[model samples]
Target: MYINPEQLSSYAAKFINLLIDYSPKLISAFLVLFVGLYAIKFINRIIRKIMEKRNLDPTLTKFLADILLWALRILLFVTFISNLGIETSSFVAILGAMGLAVGLSLQGSLSNFAGGMLIIVFKPFKVGDTIEAQGVIATVLEIQIFVTKMLTGNNQTVFVPNGALSNGTIINYSMQGERRADLTFSVSYDSDIKKAKDILLEVLNKNPKVLQKPAPEVFVKNLSASSVDFAVRPWAKNANYGAVFSETLEDCKTALDQAGISVQPFTLQK
Candidate 1:
């Protein structure tokens, strides 16, 4: 095609006019973008410091900070486009529609994420805590955005969804720093109740793992056709709960056996 010098010069002049008209806004947009980014960084740093001082979980801190950073960036991007004389209402509408579609498709995941946020903020349980939730008793290994990794007593790794975990009943055994071990021992109905009780108490007292402040107690819990049941309650540090429970059970039986008090099997009620 043959080019016209006059038309070519006119096109160039229009391009220059457009650039000149938008230059100030463009500069302002770039300036805002850089300043906004720095401000976001400063805000995140301050938030992290506050969360750390409040002893919030490290995982939650990082996750929240990243989320805030991206949200601010998106807002800044919309402002930049608007500054360049681009209509932004339609752009924002499109983003909202896209977000709604994605949110609908990820309802379950969103529920779990919300539940995780609640857990992290309220702290119903923490890592290393032994919690019983969803009928599974386990020690918390990690608390992720959607699931909590737990190590069960049988050495199994279980991933419990945060949605169910947060909504259900959670028994945190380590929260109180101490746990009471409820142990029941059965003896032949012929055994002396007082003597048996003394033996059980002695067993608990001798165990170094048992806490002394709460004071262990042993009392007759039930009387059946063949045996008498003793409820032995012992308080110990959460870390020693299992040890105290097992050791005291063994020691109580040994003491009773030495006293000629025959230990009997628990009789089932019809």
Candidate 2:
């Protein structure tokens, strides 16, 4: 269809006026979005400074504050989009569905994260402590977000899931300022008990690492099938534990053997 020039010019002028009418909404939407964004950023900076002043762990403070900041920014985004008349129910529904699926898939990981929080709160064992947990002996290296790192006595690095550690038995050797030096040695049933006890006392007395305050105890604890067991308990500083334990056991055996007491032999294997 052919149109007259006057009619076309009138439509063009009306279209320009309509553009002018909507321009304010567009600009306001943009201005609100940017202002909200900057405001959120400024609040996040404030939270970080507060956490720093409180001497919180930098990693944890950053992580928690970032999560809060993002939540605020997302709320602003929903408000901004709504100002432009965009419905947010469907968007929220989509997020909920995705969150449920992700939570199901990462249940164990989420539990570990929760355990990490508990660890930070309770602090049963800090980094550099020697501990025995679940029969695994190690020195704590780092307390991370989801797992704890350790250096084993054998010089191997190990990572334990935080949840497992939190629920399992933990023996922090470093917690006790002093440790009992435990040693067990078997001798033939015919050996002299009094002499053995005397020798053990002598061994402990000579060792400067041993603590004299506890008063070392020596006993013939058991009469095994092949030999008699003596449980030697001596107290000492934790720092000298391994050394004292090793030396005392070796010397006890050697001195007993020199006194003509032979350690009984037993073969359980055919």
Top candidate (lDDT): 1
lDDT of 2 by residue, 145-208 (tens): 7898899978999999888888888998888778897667677767787887788778888889
Instruction: Score residue 170 of candidate 2 by CA lDDT.
Output: 91
Global lDDT for candidate 2? 0.81
Show the lowest summed lDDT stretch of 10 residues, model 2: 261-270
Q: What would the per-residue lDDT of candidate 1 be over residues 1-270, giving only the tens digit for each residue?
A: 999999999999999999999899999988888898898889889988998999878778876877887888898899888887789999999989999999999999999999989998999998899999999999999888899999999999999999999999999999999999887888987889898898888988889999998988888888877789888899999989888978887898789989999988662221
Give the TM-score of each candidate.
0.76, 0.68
Give the poorly placed runs of model 2, Cα more than 4 Å off: 1-93, 258-260, 265-270
The reply for model 1, stretches above 4 Å from the true place, is 1-46, 54-60, 76-87, 267-270
What are the RMSD figures for all models against the true structure?
A: 4.6, 6.1
Pick the TM-score winner.
Answer: 1
- Clash pairs (backbone) in predicted model 2: none
| Candidate models: Cα lDDT each | 0.88, 0.81
* Cα distance off (Å), candidate 2, residue 29: 11
